[model samples]
Target: MKSRFTPLLAGLVLAVSSLTVQADEVQVAVAANFTAPMQKIAAEFEKDTGHKALLVFGATGKLYAQIKNGAPFQVFLAADDKTPAKLETEGDTVSGSRFTYAIGTLVLWSAKPGFVDDQGEVLKKGAFKHLAIANPKTAPYGAAAVATLTQLGLLDAIQPKLVTGENISQAYQFVVTENAELGFIALSQVMADGQMTGGSAWVVPSNLHDPIRQDAAILAKGRNQPAARALVEYLKGDKAAAIIKSYGYAL
Candidate 1:
């Protein structure tokens, strides 16, 4: 029995080797705030090219740390330019593959109607019991939320009511689940077909905070791969950019 089993081991290896030689999946590390859009983009990208996007969503900072520690992601679509720029400076990314894909918008949103009015001084009015924001320490969007509140002179007034999510996606979840009466989140979190749905929002005037510019870059892990380079180039094309803009992002 041992001799018979040993003879088939080489055949088994040949079968597995054939499968490995055929299919290659492109792994991408994406920001949590990009969940919906990336899912859509991945589908479109898969259809356009034979390659598939093995999408992983997490905070941009965490993804950076993971990549530094040898996570095998080929591309990174960060929530901000900082991480990508740092990767480039650290020689962890392809020099020319960096590009801004979209300008994100921060909004104060609520699942319930009239729960948020970004322009109506809702925070200063003190109408809500709780306001959720992402943990500014980890999320760029959350940091921007803090910056916006500070710029409006409402940071002090809103401090006590703040509830922090581990990331922007969770912050949106807090508002959606009614755990938070209102919260600051990425505008894309609530947008569909280039418009907002379900609740009223003020669209937080851009002047109140720094722009939310999302950038993508091909990591060193992908510098030598044609499929990864193709994906990065496709993201910059008119078709992909159009889809990005349709999801309430400004390209």
Candidate 2:
């Protein structure tokens, strides 16, 4: 019996050893607008590759600053293309390591049903007491919102009622919690399965602002990391693209 069990034990030890050798923990900094889809992608990546993505979420600008200052993040998924290109120019990211991952969609949303119309005429009326927006300086989605307001000539009218959040996620939260009557937020935040879950929203037209061409980059710290390289590849795969599309992001 001992001899028969010895081979089984040896096989088990080799299997465990192989798993330990292949498993890698990749540190990632992600933009808040991409949170939900990324969470799904991370789970799928870990399951399929046996590599873990330890994620930290924030405004893209803040995350970029952190990466610049030697934060331990091995990868960055920015909400805009310019920041990653800037990092590459500054030698903070691997050369030829950046690529467009997804194009984001912005929405004018309200927690209450029927409060926001399809054409976004509520802004013209200025009936709401507070309007929540992410800080434009730190959030690409917020910058788009500002651009839309500027195009409509509503920026000056809405300035006083604005309630700014540090990031898009927090701006969405403010509307959900009734801290603000409505908000300009990423469509992904309030969407699931390609439909809006609960609330009234106007899917802002693409012409209203610059295209939010989100980009991903391998940081200098991850220049030679196998896991970091794998994660970037996985994000561009069909599975991840489908997941991102389900949340209303354009591929």
- Tell me which residue pairs clash in candidate 1: none
Q: Model 2, range 1-251, lDDT digits (tens) per residue?
A: 79999999999999999999988989999999999999999999999999999999999999998988889999999999999999999999988889999999999999999999999999999999999999999999999999999999999999999999999999999999989999999999999998889989999999999999999999999998889999999998999999999999998
Candidate 2 vs. true structure, TM-score: 0.97
TM-score of each: 0.89, 0.97
Regions of candidate 2 where Cα sits further than 4 Å from its true position: 4-8
Candidate topping TM-score: 2
Q: lDDT of each structure?
A: 0.86, 0.95
For candidate 1, lDDT tens digit of each residue in 134-206? 8887788998999999988889988999999988988998999999888999888898788787886767888
Q: Which ten residues in a row have the lowest lDDT in candidate 2?
A: 88-97
Q: What is the lDDT of residue 77 in candidate 1?
A: 95
Clashing pairs in 2: none
